[model samples]
Target: MKQRHEVLFKQLESYRSYVLSVMENVTEEEAEIIPFGFKNNIRWNLGHMYLDQYLWIQAVTKEKCGVPEQFKSWFGFGTTPANFNSETPSLEELKNLLKEQPAKIKDVYGERLEEEFPPTEMGMHTIEQVLIRTIFHEGMHLQAILDLKKCIQPSF
Candidate 1:
């Protein structure tokens, strides 16, 4: 892997660790609360962050990345906790998936960061570009998780 790609993966791991740290003390009940003025809960943000990477990467590669089929309905853009069924993954399950994801992505795509594909509507044409976009997306959701945490535990 290139030095730049290694740096990118390190950044990815660091940000994901920050996200998981913010979530460490949250209980499942806390995760489910969609507090006033928020469209989703911490749980939805977590699930969405996990699913969005796969969706964007698959879009760029034109290949599936093993994201669970139900994730689309549960965590896709515009999806809300209201739409989630019993089939929706629990907070622990989602956390486990999120915890493993960075390493999995590194193992799977570390060498192909510069491989270009046809540009999507967003003009992303390389694995590195897609990873950058997903990192930003994760940060956005990380903010959401923080906000939800504040709302769920005023003392937080």
Candidate 2:
């Protein structure tokens, strides 16, 4: 892998580690709490984090996304906890997926980061560029998670 790819993957891993660390103490019930003024809970944000990367990568690579079909309906953009069913993944499940995802992504795409795609509206034409965008998106959801955490655990 190129030095830049190594740095990008390290950034991805570090960000995911920070997210997991923040969520490590959250109980399942806490994860499910949709605090006032928030459309979704920490659980939804986590699932959205898992789903968004796959969706964006699919868009750039034109490969079929590997996540289950229900992911789109339950965790895709514009989705909320109201859309969840009994079949929705538990927080533990989502966390496990999130924990493993950076490694999985590196394994799959590490060598392909420089591969060019048609430019997105944002002019992102490489897998590396797409990964950068996803990292920013993850930060956005991380903020949402922190906000929900503070609401659910005022002392947190």
In every candidate, how many clashes are there? 0, 0
- Candidate 2, run of 10 with poorest lDDT: 118-127
TM-score of 2: 0.97
Writing each residue's lDDT as its tens digit, candidate 2 over 13-68 gives 99999999999999999999987798999999999999999988888888886899
Best prediction by TM-score = 1
RMSD of 2: 0.9
Error of 1 at 6 (Å): 0.4
Tell me the whole-model lDDT of each prediction, alpha carbons only: 0.93, 0.93
Angstrom error of the Cα, residue 48, model 2: value is: 0.4
- How does model 2 fare in lDDT? 0.93
lDDT of 1 by residue, 111-148 (tens): 88899899999999998999999999999899889888
Scanning candidate 1 in windows of ten residues, the lowest lDDT window is 143-152
Show pairs that collide, candidate 2. none
TM-score, every prediction? 0.98, 0.97
